[model samples]
Target chain A: MKAPDFSYFEAQNIEDAIKYKSEDDEAVILAGGQSLLPALNMRLSSPSCLIDISKINNLNEIKIEGDFINIGALATHSDVMNNDLVHEKLPCLVDILKMVAHAAIRNKGTHGGSIAYGDPAAELPAFAVAMNAEIVLSGLSGQRIVNAKDFYLGLFETDLKSDEILIAIRYPLLDVNQHLIFDEVCRRHGDYAMAGLMAKVELDQSKINNLDLVYFATGDKPNVGQNTAKLVIDDGYDYEKLKKSLASEIDFAGDLNSSSEMKLHLATILINKILNKLER
Target chain B: MSAKNSVNISFSVNGENFDDVTVPTRQHLADYLRSQGLTGTHLGCEQGACGACTIEMDGVAVRSCLVLASQANGSSITTVEGFDDEVMQKVKNNFLKHNAFQCGFCSPGMLMTTKEIISSKKKLSRDEIRSEISGNYCRCTGYQSIVDAIEETINEIN
Candidate 1:
């Protein structure tokens, strides 16, 4: 399939990319092209001009800047795994990161690109939301930061303006006492998760302290399940009690892969998987 | 807009520089590379779901069919054909040892995927290795052998 006719300009840096994008009304930033490329080829989106931003430096680094781990927008999945900060500080991020499609696609796909692509089934965004991470977006006039909760409006939609390019995503570090357990059910090993959950829990003796749950691929948008998290904390020690809540109260939805009932069932199964592991 | 049809773009395909290729803005990197006689990169799903068109551009592996030819200007590319790296040979041996290829359409992309993994030297567990190769789909249902191949290759390299 051929994309619609357009002009391409290789931006020397992010400034040039932003400048060119600001100057034109119909231009889109090209990163890994994992999602955008397929969309353009499938005739889903046809921009008048393309701005390639591969040459931008430092946009691919995962740095520990004080209390937050700053993941650059251009940072590839391979880069994330290689970075010492991410591996040490937020290696829980690795569990979810490792679940992305394949090595080839991850090497080309970027952190900002996946968050920008806003695939509800994507593990990263769910992680971002679970961690209450914030996105840094830069447009012609200035830059704005939006929490992951607000960044996602709908399926494949973000608050980003076409003129703006996402710069990075930052999240506060979880405490040493916190244990994270992530579980996703994919048709196969590497495909998009049919249903996934990233849960952060802290146990005080035998009682659950905080049972925060975030699930993806269950609906058109990620359900933070703040209520479910609270309920899990209150009744979490008994896995069966929380398991029933996950199945009944979570209210999961589905897309092309499964049904609403199936999504909900898978979500509960995945949540149980996490709870069981951490319980060990 | 028809007047702005042709744009000169440059990309390094199979580790060689071809700075004079002028392609339509709509042309895909997969098409451009194949047109340049680098037919090693196979095409399977035509969508991002399959890794058949996997290639490294500017050190990052991407779906060639999804990338516009113009997007790859000044980028370095690596493909399966004409690959002679030791790790690549080891990956081939892994496939041979495990007999991973049935249809073989997915093998080229798998090799490319494995190439990216070995180059980084990132610590990979069995679970990570399995997830990393998930982008490529094999219809022959030979994933066990495929994973075995990658594991063997990884072990040989160490």
Candidate 2:
């Protein structure tokens, strides 16, 4: 299917993109175009204008800034996957990115675009929540930062306003004792996961000190298992007990492939899998 | 159509420069390439799922079906017809030797993605090769021959 006709404007910088977006209420920002183009081609979305921000300079940088790693919005998944900083500091991101789509898609798909698109099945958003990442948004009114947890509202929905542009994401550097584990169950290697989990664990003297578990594809948005995390910390890590408690914590949603019950089962399996890895 | 619905883009395709080419904003890169008679870039799925329309944009493999023609301005693109290097030649020969494709609709994308995997210079096992090319579906060959062909090419190159 061909995309519907729309006006296009190539913005030279962030300000230009903001200005162009401000002029039209129906204008949509074009990042890597990996997801948006597909939506457009399928006619699922049709906007009056497309603000192309791929050419914005300094909008694709992946660099370390003091205590956080600042990933520019336009940075492609390939760029993030191959960066030495991400490799050394956030290896879990590299691990999850390997399972994201394929090489061709990753070569063009942007990191911030994934978060902005707010697909509940996507791994990045769950990762952002697990790592306590901060999302930076810019609009005509200046800029504001939103925590990754609060940024996601519902299915394919985000706190991103139509006039605001996602500029960068800041992920705090992991402490020496902290470890991150991510795993997903999908039909194929690159397909969206039926259920996935990203866990950040910090162990103090062989006891779970801090545990954060974020599940994707099992709910409307990234489902933070706050109660489950509390259970693990309070009662220690017991697979049977934790599995029994998960059903009540997360309100699993059914999809075309997996039912809500099946998703809950898969989510429990992922939790057990991640916990085993953390114990090792 | 109004002038606002179209964009003038200049880009390079297979080492050939195209300047001031006007295209509809709705047209994707795959359609744009086909319009220029570069039909080798197939379009199995207009969406990014099927890798039949994969091409090299600035030395990276991407789904042309998902890239807008207007967004490709000033970029260098290489289609399956652009392969003339020794490595690509060897890859083609290996594909033929292994009978990697049947129906041949997926060959261009398979070749383009295989070229990328090989160029990565990583020592990939057969399982890794299969995983790397998972995006490019080959319904006819069942992917055994394709993996064999890519594995042979990597062994030869290494």
Best by TM-score: 2
- Model 1 gets an lDDT of 0.79
Off by over 4 Å in 1: A23-26, A237-251, B1-6, B58-61, B85-104, B114-133, B141-158
lDDT for residue A44 in candidate 1, whole number 0-100? 88
Candidate 1 chain B worst ten-residue window by lDDT: B1-10
Index of the highest-DockQ prediction: 2
B41-158 per-residue lDDT for model 2 (tens digits):
9998898998999999999999999999998999999999997699998998998998886799999999999889988898899999988889998868559989989999999999
Chain B, candidate 1: TM? 0.91
Q: Which lDDT tens digits does candidate 2 get at residues A1-280?
A: 9888898888887887887787788888889988888888889998998888899899899999999999999999999998999898888888899989999999999999998988899999999999999999999899999999999999888998767999999999999888888889999899999999999999898788999999999999999988888887897667677777888887889999899988888887787788788777
Which DockQ values do the candidates obtain, in the order shown? 0.51, 0.63
Minimum summed lDDT over a 10-residue window in model 2 chain B is located at: B1-10
- TM-score, chain B only, every model? 0.91, 0.96
Q: How accurate is candidate 2 locally (lDDT)?
A: 0.90
Candidate 1 per-residue C-alpha lDDT over A1-280 given as tens digits, one digit per residue, 9 for 90 to 100: 6677777777777777878887787887788887787788778888888777866888887888778999999988878977888888998888677778766667677888888888888888888888889899998888999999899988787888867899999988888777778988888766888888988777787567887788899876677777668866665544566566666655667678888778777776676688778868
Q: Candidate 2: where are CA atoms >4 Å away?
A: A236-244, B1-3
